[model samples]
Target chain A: MNVLLPQPYLLFLGETTEPGYAKTAFGLRDWSPQRCLGEFSLPGATVSTGLPFLTPVQARNAGARAMVIGVANAGGFIPQTWIGALLEAMQAGLDLVGGMHARLRDIPVLRDAAMQYGRRLIDVREPPAKIPVASGRRRTGRRLLTVGTDCALGKKYTALALARAFQAHGEAATFRATGQTGILIAGGGIPMDAVVADFAAGAAELLTPDADPTHWDVIEGQGSLLHPAYAGVSLALLHGSQPDVFVVCHEPGRDRVLGHPDFAVPDVLDVIDLTIRLGSRTSPHIRCAGVSLNTAKMDTGAALRLFDRESERLGMPVGDPMRGGKAFERLVKACLA
Target chain B: MNVLLPQPYLLFLGETTEPGYAKTAFGLRDWSPQRCLGEFSLPGATVSTGLPFLTPVQARNAGARAMVIGVANAGGFIPQTWIGALLEAMQAGLDLVGGMHARLRDIPVLRDAAMQYGRRLIDVREPPAKIPVASGRRRTGRRLLTVGTDCALGKKYTALALARAFQAHGEAATFRATGQTGILIAGGGIPMDAVVADFAAGAAELLTPDADPTHWDVIEGQGSLLHPAYAGVSLALLHGSQPDVFVVCHEPGRDRVLGHPDFAVPDVLDVIDLTIRLGSRTSPHIRCAGVSLNTAKMDTGAALRLFDRESERLGMPVGDPMRGGKAFERLVKACLA
Candidate 1:
């Protein structure tokens, strides 16, 4: 009588594949099936069809009683001290814990293994990151938007030109449930109301259901709010709905430095302080409020004068959420200067 | 007393998430508890948490075996025929089917339910279309060569530049051994000499059991010969090394007017033309020898001047296959004239 059962979750493969476990750890755009249960294999190991080879001891024996891996990719870009050492090795859940030493001073072996693994770390706490706000009232205040470039690039023309850059700022930008209310939605929070029906149902369109609108403060997160499920949905929307201004969008050709093998040379001020540590991973009342770019591959006036001189050295508006909100609210108070 | 053992070959995600499984027909790929095995109730999907919202009989009453449906736009590229009609309707021996009378020519009401479901019809055994060969190469002597692609974009950089383009056309290629050759060896098959040792592990880097040189002639297939176990190891090296000349290497991009969503595009030219429409597939002193092209995303001098003016409108010289062997014996007497 021995039962246990729970495994099947080792994840990884970022940069488009997620039809949420598209048939065992992603494959079938190029077809690689033999066996998979909760996959993360990333064709880094065989599959053109020499069936299920896996091995990191078969990904610690077929990953899934949980593991998520994919630290983006230095090629596509990763640092913030490699996502704070993979969120301090997933909150140091043992393997001798230790993490978050800030931008890891140019990796001195992950800064001496975060000073002997921050004494077997653990405080899996995380809260403070707000900024979702528009939860209702906007018929006169005005807001509507969408943005993209991951999950097969350009999130539906950056979320329908971010609802026509909030109905070109005269006000009331609409799309679903008319006078709309709020719904930001990126590659995130989509229980579908279009972001192309939540990226063609990957992860089964995130469990499918969303009328949103308690006047609509939807916003959304994931493709990388310093990631780890965009820091677990910005600390579950700052312990549930405190948002006000966060916008981040981006593509000064993947934040400067190129000839791309996916942007290798990064550091235009460490990718504009990794786009303001993705709004300082939520909670300084969460104020980043501006960046938007995906000009297909730049030159929109030299990517808005090098993203308006790096949103004027991050203080933050480089603007054009498909153009409006009065020049994206003067590029969000010149990026909240 | 519960003995239902045969529920093991599973798959499912949508026949409206299957419950008393009787309706919704197929086209699958959503579900991932490590490629599933039994018991059912999946819905955590992601790209920012999706799927989970079941209803279509509360996702077939959250229980037992098969389903995976999810695909919405793969033209702009890659959805793989809605994941082979939902893993042939969630796996059990298979049947899903195909399309055309010209893709139901403007969906005339699903072309009368595909002529009353002529066995679910998939564009009738695809990616194979061209045949007529018999041109040169056989002085009744030489043997094995295999090279590939006549279409499926860069099959491992044209099978390691057709093993250094068959040792710069003097023959002798090598890199043999196949063993689960999928995504370079993570236990998948990364030793064809460390897949050409670099160039991003191309011809499975010459199938290395290690230490090279054994007078060439081995070759093996790549992009795991569109995998039904490397297309039965490329149909047992095209029927036990009768080789002589299989070089193809495809993807000269567009001109087959619309339809290359690549699962090796109808997977390796529709299951390696069951040995080129049987005559026990080639080597009747083999000839359709050369084709190469991997000029990475075509325009190889405008696809060799549109295949030398369509090999002079089919009077042969099947377009500059490096031109001669008497213009491929006048393009094999204008392909069986």
Candidate 2:
């Protein structure tokens, strides 16, 4: 299913992860958006994650009719300071969309302003539809899951990029989002973390329900097996999706688990093994198909080198999907085959 | 908190696990029951896990004013076959209580029958009270958690038994239940698995709110790290409770993970390590205090031998609480000290 938003789109990328936003916004810009106006961020932000920041007036001038809250925050709360800018965009008659835990429509002033301005308020964190409890029943279609080394480390990015690449190759592929950012981009999948625990897996199952036997359900994973704060969600996704093939996603040059500095990053092989073991609970034949690295922080040459090194070490297809190469696509084709 | 049930109780132990029901009923009978009139099962049911089967009329004759559904079924569904028996007891003017996911009131016939008879339909699976999302806040008190090798291997039994032992030793200890059976016995405590995944831990944190600094909160555990069907709940409980010390509980003779024969039972030390690691996400200094073996199936001599072997190997206290011995109690005292 396609995400419906008014066009052209203005993405709000808070100063946090500029490169991550740029990748997500641009990724969606290519796949879903009719046209991209520009990105927005706090003033004096040095990071260059997504597209360059556009003022609310500039966004209006660019013919942007929808404002997307693109920044992914750890706390998930959209700070009050961002409200004034959002209100301006809403008044500009741009429909508002956000992936934050705090709903945009939940803010009384924002709701009233949106109502007055005749603009839609979309809370992407809220499931677009009701989700059912997963039966853990075996389905006919093949599923590919993007397991990650840590949160915000590009599991969704790899899944989305691979889905696009698979479609480009004329294969039947669907992207299943399991988190807020992915839900915002995918336009229809449930936020697995926000769901009741029992249904977390069920929601994942619902995303790619009743597809052709050969259809590849590319599921977006959340959290990390090695992540201390959020492994329960990750495990639930692993068991729920019951992916036949899983591509391990990681960020190069990170020695610590995300948001946890004291804990050393686990070996990628260990993460792969643990994920497969956990995934095998629901699907006994589950395997690690490849590795997708998030190398947004590195230069293209260095990123490719790291990719090749990991590829040689794990003896699996490994590459940076953001490198604008067919490396990840090739891996996806082999795994689905 | 103690579970207050209307007397006299007639426990419904179906054909599933007679030994299981007998154990659970007898455990509660020892801890909280005013008196267990007798256990009831279908006629011709050979297993004598608990008290002998009593017909509804006979149960009422024996002064059973309440009928407790004693079987722990997967998916928590009370089958239609059992409804007839339950209805009979309900019409006999006995109150009804069950821990199944299917609430008794949802059955129209049962509801009407119950209404006609003025019987109280107590669905123990329902949350007894409102639960909040866990704040992961550091509250004053010491919590001793029961981390099991798998579910229904007697985490609650060990916890309740240990709590009683602590009280007998003149220590300020509270038994915090995290599942239905324990909740039914404890009178109040959140059903951790029934809770939303996000708040599973928070609900656990609320169980022993504002306790004395020196008090020992012996929290009942649910599920296991190795359990394929229910590990997410286990991990959530581990992280939410933020126990100062965790006691690893296991069954000595079990060779495979429950319900998943393809999976071998993980090492007890591994379960302990994983729990400590997961629990430390909220409480960094958390430690595995000891091991509690559910050796109810073994003879006392063999159970004590296995306990000795494990205690020697782990260099920690290990014992069977069901042995009517003080081995586990001494371990708890030493760990808390």
* Residue B38 miss distance in model 1 (angstroms): 36
- The segments of candidate 1 whose C-alpha lies over 4 angstroms from its true place after superposition are A1-327, A330-337, B1-161, B164-337
lDDT of each: 0.31, 0.75
Q: What is the C-alpha local distance difference test score of candidate 1?
A: 0.31
lDDT tens digits, residues B214-280, model 1? 3344344432222211221232234333444444444455333122222223222332342343212
Chain B TM-score (each prediction, in order)? 0.24, 0.81
Residue B228 of model 2, lDDT score: 60
Off by over 4 Å in 2: A1-27, A34-98, A104-122, A127-134, A208-210, A326-330, B1-143, B170-172, B180-188, B199-215, B242-320, B326-337
Instruction: Give Cα distance to truth, residue B25, candidate 2, Å.
Output: 10
TM-score of 2: 0.67
lDDT (tens digit, per residue) of candidate 1 on A1-337: 1111122323333233334322222321111121123333433323222224333334444442323332223243334333443344333331211112222234455445546654222111111122121111112221222222221233233334544444454333323210011111111122221111101112111221233332222233323212211111222222222233445555554542222122233333433343333222222233445556555566466655665676677655656555443445675443323
- The DockQ of each candidate is 0.01, 0.22
Q: Provide the TM-score for each candidate, comma-separated.
A: 0.25, 0.67
